[model samples]
Target: MRLAIVLYPGFADWECALLMAAARTHLGVEIDVATADGATVTSMGGLDVSPHLSIDALDPAGFDGLVICGGTVWDTAEAPDLSGTIRTFDRDKRLVAAICGGVNALATCGLLDRVEHTGNNAASLAALHGYRGQTHYREQPQALRSGHVITAAGTAPISFAGEILRGLGLGSEELDGFLALYGREHVAATSAG
Candidate 1:
């Protein structure tokens, strides 16, 4: 499977690290990092990311899913307008996942208005997010998947990645193992002790 992961200046590296690593190394999925201008950008944690393509250049038909990573940039006045790209992905029924501030992108595109979704918090984002999806919001600590759309808080990368893997058709057994390993590493250590 191929996934187009969106990135930008101040992108939250922690929010998507596990998802990308696990998806690539364990699931063998192909990932293409996209930026607003197809150039290298620095993450909030100071990591530099060189994107493979520009978000504006991507064709939804060429990929199986889209991943929009969280970042403070999404809350700013100059957030990249990814509405067209997100709409195309949704129209084609491809998996569309967004986390934390990335949820603002989907909300602004009106994709969350009909689907159950969660993010950092609804109240804090309501003013910045003028979208009408409030009634469907679920205040969960993990990621929530509705139909082809998946949304999560910034702190739940494990659940976020798990849902993405599950949506990509990974078997339950494999998912269980993945979650077991990542979701509860301390359990394994304690059990071994």
Candidate 2:
């Protein structure tokens, strides 16, 4: 699968990393990390990641899926009209996944209407109210799969990645392999408690 991960100036590094690791270790998929521009992108935590393509340079038809990374940037700065790009991909029936505040970006693009979604904060949840879709909030990291739109609550990277894998026609067993490769045993144990 050819996956495109949206990167902004202040995205979360761990979010991108986990998804990339899952794509690489589990699905054995070719992943491309892209930014609004071809420039290097930084995370909210000050980590920098280089991009494989810029939004302007990417051909939406070439990607199998697009994963938008969310953080403080989604709330403050204006993101590229990713909704249009996502809509184009959706028209072709490609998979689109958003995490945390990235859902806000998708909402702005009119993609969340009539789709079930969850976000990181109360503000994001409130934003979803104006959307045409069923909005839900839960404590557990749950992946709500509604057709082509795949969403997850905040900090649910494992579940989020699992959802993406499943959407790509992979299995939960692949997600487990990714977790093991990433040395997420401690996190799994802690969360399981």
Candidate 3:
């Protein structure tokens, strides 16, 4: 399977780390990173990533799915408009996943209008000038999936990864095992203080 992952300035590197790792390690999926412009971008955590292509250069038909990483850039009026790209992916029934501020891209495109989706919060999304998908928002504390669209809150990267793995058609047994290991490590680290 081929997946297109979008990146931008100040993206949350942690959000898609597990998903990309598991996808490559277990599913053997091919991932191509992209950005609005075909250039290197920096993450919120200060990691630099060079995208394989620009969003304008990507064709939804060439990939099996798309993943939009969250960033502070999503809230800006100057952020690149990816609505057309998202619409193309959705029209083909390809998996579309977003987290945190990334959902703002989907919201801006009206992709969440009729789908059950969760993000930073309903209010954060409602704050967008032209967001008309408020009624379809879910107040879940974790990830929620509706049809081909999957969304999650900023703090739920593990849950986000689990759902994306599910979208990848990874077997439940494999998914559960990976999540169990991830959860244990995460809990251990957070509780070590």
Candidate 4:
């Protein structure tokens, strides 16, 4: 499976690093970086990435999903309105995932209005003009997948990754174990033979 990770200036790079590593290492998912203008974007951590694919250039047919990394730009007044690209992916039945401030984009696009989604909190979303999905908002520390959309708080990348895998039909016992190891203090269950 192939996934496109959308990045922006001042993005939270660490949020998706473990997810990308684990998914690619375990599931063999091909992950690519995409930016707003097919140029380089610097993360909040000062990591620079030069992406070849522009957000407008992504073809939903060619990629299985779009994972948007949270960035401060998303919370600014001049946030990128990703409605068109996001809707295109959703229209084609492809996975649409976002976390932290990235969730604001989904809120701006009104996808969260139709599905149960979680982010940093519901109060923050209420500030957005396009957000009318308050009733559908779920307050949780983990990532949630409703229909084909996945949303998460910034602190829940491990959970977000697991949900992404689950959304991609890659959920399994091993996957659970994989996430458990990363998410918490895992306790292994033993079977009596």
Candidate 5:
């Protein structure tokens, strides 16, 4: 299946690295990167990446799902209005995944209002101010999924990836195997320490 990943300047690198790698290796999913302008965008860690398409140019129907990577910009005035694209994915019944500050896009678009979700924190998400979906927020430890939306805190990329794989219909055994290969210890350690 083909998936579209949205990246902005300062997008989080860790959020999708393992997911992208494991999904490619184990699930053979095809991925394309998109940005507001189809220009080269840099991650928060200073890695440069060129987007495969611009948001306006990407056809929602061409992708099986959409994944949004978080960055500080999601919380800023510079954030792009992704509501239309996100809504299209929702209408099409495709998976919509967001983590950390990327959750802001979902929140801003009114998608989080109906589905249970978690983010960097309640406050960061609450700070979205005009969003009327606060009551739908759940105070989970990390990842949360409701309907077609998958959300996680910035620090929970592994769990985030797990939730996304689960949404992709990967069997529990396959998820367990994939996690054992790359997640078990890290998840345990992160939880413990």
Candidate 6:
């Protein structure tokens, strides 16, 4: 499967990294990183990522799934055009996943109105007031899945990617093997903690 991950000027790096790792390891999926512009995308932590495709150059039909990473970019009142792009992908039946404040983009495009989802925090949940399927995943600690939409809380990129892998029908054993092969200490830490 082909996955398209959208990047922006201020996206979260860990979110992108974890999802890309999941796509590569569990499903052996081809991941194409795209940006609103062809320019290098930078994260809030000053990390720079080069996208494989520009938003204007992307074909919504080419991807089996699309994930939008959240960060400071979504906190603004001015809506981004990327929301429309995500909406187009959703209309095409591509699996759409949003992480953290990325839900803001989905909300702005009206995609979250009746779709189940979760966000960064209580304020983030409040922001998605018009959304009908909103739920808090305190016990599980991550908004893993809600129908076709997969939403995750802030900084939970690893779990978010795992949920996506599960949604794509990749077994947990495969994900565990991948994590082991990749020397991902975070999983170990999570398990131990």
Best by lDDT: 4
Put down candidate 6 lDDT per residue, 51-112, tens digits, no spaces.
Answer: 89887776777877888888777777643656667778778877788887786777666776
Error of 2 at 130 (Å): 6.5
Tens-digit per-residue lDDT, 66-121, candidate 3: 99999888878777788999999999899999998899989988899888899998
lDDT of 2 at 103: 79
For each candidate, the alpha-carbon lDDT, in order, equals: 0.89, 0.74, 0.87, 0.91, 0.85, 0.72
The residue-level lDDT of candidate 3 at 76 comes to 82
Q: Select the stronger candidate by TM-score from 2 and 6.
A: 2
Give the count of colliding residue pairs in each prediction. Answer: 0, 2, 0, 0, 0, 0
lDDT of 2 by residue, 1-193 (tens): 7998888887876665777885887568999888886889889888878889987665667988888887777666464567667778778888998887787766777777666666665455555434544344433456667777887766777768877878888876646676566556455444455
TM-score of 2: 0.82
How do all the candidates rank in terms of lDDT, highest first?
4, 1, 3, 5, 2, 6
lDDT of 5: 0.85
* Cα-based TM-score, every candidate: 0.93, 0.82, 0.92, 0.93, 0.91, 0.80
Candidate 1 vs 4: which has more lDDT? 4
Better of 3 and 5 by lDDT: 3
Model 6 quality (TM-score): 0.80
Comparing 2 with 5 on lDDT, the higher-scoring candidate is 5
Question: Which lDDT tens digits does candidate 1 get at residues 42-113?
Answer: 999899999999998888889989999999798788887788999999999999999999999999889988
Worst 10 residues of 4 by lDDT: 181-190
- Runs of candidate 1 with Cα error greater than 4 angstroms are 185-193
Which residue runs does candidate 6 get wrong by more than 4 Å? Answer: 128-140, 176-193
